[model samples]
Target chain A: MFDLPDAAALPRLRPASSRPSLGLIGHGAFGAFIHPHLARFFDVVVHDPADSASASLASVAARQIVVLAVPLAQMRGVAVAIAPHLRPGALVVDVCSLKVAPLAILAEALPEHVEILGTHPLFGPQSGKAGIAGLRIALCPLRGRRARLAAQLLRRGFGLEVVQSTAEEHDRQMAYVQGLTHIVSRIVLAMDVPPLELRTTTFEHLTRMVDTVRHDSEALFRTIARDNPYAAEVRERFAAATAEVMERLGAP
Target chain B: MFDLPDAAALPRLRPASSRPSLGLIGHGAFGAFIHPHLARFFDVVVHDPADSASASLASVAARQIVVLAVPLAQMRGVAVAIAPHLRPGALVVDVCSLKVAPLAILAEALPEHVEILGTHPLFGPQSGKAGIAGLRIALCPLRGRRARLAAQLLRRGFGLEVVQSTAEEHDRQMAYVQGLTHIVSRIVLAMDVPPLELRTTTFEHLTRMVDTVRHDSEALFRTIARDNPYAAEVRERFAAATAEVMERLGAP
Candidate 1:
């Protein structure tokens, strides 16, 4: 259902040798998970400060497409570092959990001649462990025409369901989506309830959600819980709702 | 996986005409849901004050096997009303959400000659709509050996997974399983968030869990959140954990 137009229905494709070079920053868990999928269509080069085998930042930034896979906290620094080396008309994409701030940073730091696409792939290494086919990716065409092509490519190449949204709209919805999910998961995990043998279907679904986000990095949690502009309000509302429920139940 | 020994391996079974009479009280949502399932193997008779078509209380209570599917608050009253009519050696079962208090009430109100089986079928009309195969039902043999036979029948006949435990153990585990799920779902529902266009896999799981319990009666919610002896502690722990998480995130 997520398939786009047949690969042959599009403009003529370049040969493998002439395929566009793509650079990826941050060889983190998500970066590693996505690297292979991106490699199927591009001559991919990766640069991560912590990886000894990574390509130099300058060479990686000069590619036709550059994807920033860094943490939200580090996005600005990476964007600034790559700005000087990014070739004109390069399509710069960011795979951040929150869209508004990261996209803003990319827009501010990148050269005006470059294109920007903001994406948040809804699945992660844990959720996408089997395969990413039919998974969702939210695409924000922050700047220029390349973002539309990127959305089409995401759909056609990877069989992803792309939801086209603006950075503001994406982050607004994510305040409830990612923000509420992560907070609830963290609370349940912290409650430290032992493994229960009497599992209900609802409880199993709740725990599955908890387990999927259990291994996520603390940085991602902070990004979703704090970095998103609307997340704090959502968190506060949830906490208030929880308190009201406890009060109604007369739980002291 | 929930199957018991083959039905043919059991002691010779009675023909359909000779099937033991089963009486069910409190034809509420759950009572109606389970009525057909019980009718499959027994000559089932149902009694409910609200259901005008139901059988008379005295006649229903005098059956060879009697089941009470009532709210936790009304359990004692139902047991008291049925006490004088229970036949000797009659197998009486109460399907309440919490096992401890209801089992205690049944033990106190019912005559010593009548057997008592406390069961918490971990599903209802909403979750069981698709079919109850492999669904779980907690069985507490409070006062009889007949509980084992009932468990076997539940497995072999209805494809139910029976977890046999004492009343205390059942309530304790359900404090986490049912208690946590209901409370979280209530909080999310009360938050009154609009339908989101951007949904993650985890969020989808969360919402699905919420939807399963959305139609549950307020009485069931109270039974899970207030009737269970251990539920308050779990709710308190969840509240405390939510506070800690919000504080850590610097969320007001």
Candidate 2:
């Protein structure tokens, strides 16, 4: 019974300046998705070395909250490159799926004057039609007063169910949530059923899962399955259960 | 583009009174599910040594279609016992998940006078609010004229997408559809995340699959995994794909 406050009841959070600015690091699907929503709230700037940030995004880079939404592997390098450009006391946040490692990277790379916060939006960009209406966003605070202020702003401004969890706890839970889900989906895809013959409700559900992760970049899958410390343990338990079932069924 | 004719267009079918009265060999969850739907069309009789047939199901025992909706391991025995009581020319059908092995058992045990057909409803009985509106139902015609008539009656009356496939083909595809889905759902359950921490869209999808299968009896799981010939091959492919991903990710 959590009563989410009405949007009107929340404090009118105008970005500290005449026109608040926001910078996003990863311009991939998730970044592109949140960009439109953030643009409504602040002047948004995005940096993705892999792809050119859109013209609209590039136009707003001068004065904004710089967000590093890159892959965990490239987060440090991206943060280092963008740190010099950010205005003093500009709020910096990384939207990496994994937290602890990236949070540490952002803390060490950015200037002490710039505030840093690590966030992982639990839903994916492809969750089309099911917008971020009832979703959880995990926020792990790393740096100064501005970082806390940014988290509060997200809660007060957008009706986001913000849960404060340590970077370690976040990754541990993510191992089971993200790591096992992808693994299970990959296994289902490997079954190689000719699409014509697939007709069960269960098969359709499994195919949905496979379709969700299969198109995702290899780097993203690897980072989720290997880089996150809790992933290995979760994977082991999944493998054990699979083996046990196979043994019981005497399957090859 | 497949055009499935509406139920009203099909010829009005009447159960052949000359045939032996219908008999239901098992009164389990699946049996109870289709029982009401079937009762609407034909006079029905049930004989479940394990569980007493409900009063309503027992009331229509005089002469009707004989259905065996039992666990795979007990199916053959039930078929043998019910064979003696079936009225002459009674059309026998099974709602078992696996088809090939059970088809063979029914063919061997039932009296030649009694026609047998193996039927597998693609949707679960407990598919609560989402009723079997657009679901596919596989019908493997095993014997006589009565069996064909029974299959046609189901297609015409229920508006079910009735696909005619051999018992072998049905079992082969089921390996990927049922076996793989169950294996993936069980793996998600084995991950052992605290309920609060598991909030991802992918996780929610996985939990729905687990919830669908967890209420299923072990005998049901075993039947799909063990009795179905195609299950081992599907399981092997799933295992291989999982191993390939793990190896690619350099996971020990």
Candidate 3:
């Protein structure tokens, strides 16, 4: 299911020389990850302003397939900056946790001729530290050649399990998947430390999540809570459920 | 720290004839586990009322070491029933997750001459399905003998790490460790299921915790919430933290 366009359908894709070079904008952790794997399939043009002060934005936008790997908050600025220089018929992909916001930013900022595809490489620096083989990546095809280019590159190139999803469905599920998880971890870390001896195996397993989001930048944690539309509802439900459990047990 | 009594301390314990016969009461899942290991060190007599309604409580109490593996709520009645029959100088061990309550019940219900030892063998059937070499079992020595028998049986007999602690400290630490874990899991399971495709490595780790608490008996869960002194406080703090995070995100 992940490999939607199979080997038989490969013939329909444009030939090698006609295909676009991968334009990887933003050189953060995710950008660094997608670049090398992207290079394996096509020539990669990287534009990380942080590393090169005078980096030419037009050069990166000129590529046929561009990946937006900037922080979630920076999507708008980056999309607007590179919109004018994006080549016609190019596919601009986003690698953001929450799809709806980034997809909207990319769709409105880029020219009508440019296509959009959204993806969330669920693994990060630590999890993807080894390699991304067998890892999960959500693919939301927005405006484009049915996301054929993005699907082909992610599955065939990186050996990732591409779960085809909608921008709405991706954000809805991530509200609980990423939103609830990060909320619990961030809060638990904020609490006083429990005695080490009382940490059971299940507790150890639960805290692996604490380790997952523990060192994340405050910006990323806030983005999961604020950016996802369904996050508010999920948080309210989680808080309500916890309150009910405690109330049933009576006060402390 | 786990191996409190090294090999040198073994000599301080009584010999085979001087050591007490193991009398295991309430052959529940945990009781069955403790029986076999007790048999390895001493003769064991099991009296499970569920299996044999006419089970002679006197026979079990007559032994020198009687392990009360009854449900948390049943501890008081079980102790009262066997108190009169308990052999002189015998040690009654209560294996309950929340130590403060059970320890109090056992100490109050038993004869003053009857020694009390409280222990929580932190692993369950599923967790200990494999070898339990590195598992932890908290030993809260109460009334008499400093719980040397239980310490030796758990550490040397079962290859477990015995954490020597008082009932108060064990219950205190467990409030955050177990109370928060069970509270989050119970609340999560109560909520609507998120899309399965969105289960990441961390989410999968989290759901493992849910699985750990899912099949647990309602009586057990209620005890975790109601019996432990710190459980209510931890649950309140967790609920408040969740609410604060939602408010900070400006979400409902």
Give the candidate number with the greatest DockQ: 1
TM-scores for all candidates?
0.94, 0.86, 0.85
| lDDT-sorted candidate list, best first | 1, 3, 2
lDDT, candidate 3, B1-252, per-residue tens: 012234445447546564447788988877876666666566678898888763588998888778898898899899999999987788888889999899888888899887888988787766766767789999888898747856776777668898988888998888877887787788887776655667677787788888777777767777776678877687677767766666767743
Ten residues in a row with the worst lDDT in model 2 chain B? B1-10
Q: Could you give the interface RMSD of each candidate, to one decimal?
A: 0.8, 2.0, 1.5
**Going through the candidates in order, what is chain B's TM-score?**
0.93, 0.83, 0.86
Q: Which one wins by TM-score: 2 or 3?
A: 2
Index of the highest-TM-score prediction: 1
Report the TM-score of the second chain of model 3 against its true counterpart: 0.86
Candidate 2 regions off by >4 Å? A1-18, A51-62, A146-159, A196-198, B1-22, B52-62, B128-130, B146-156
Query: How many times do residue backbones clash in model 3?
Result: 0
Per-residue lDDT of model 3, residues A56-140, tens digit only: 7889888777788888889999999999898878878888888888888887888998888888888887677778889999998
Residue range A1-252, candidate 1, lDDT tens digits: 012223444466657776678899999999999999888778799999998889999999998888999999899999999999988888888999888898888889999988888899999998999899999999988887766667777887788999998888899999999988899999998899977898999998898899899999988998998878998789879878887887888853
Residue A177 error, candidate 2, Å: 0.4
Per-residue lDDT tens digits for candidate 2, residues B1-252, read: 111223454454545552234555567788777767665554556665665544333332224466777788887676776666666666667888988888888889888876677888887765533666567899888887554555565666776778889888888888778888787776566556565563677777776677777777878887787667877787778778888877877853
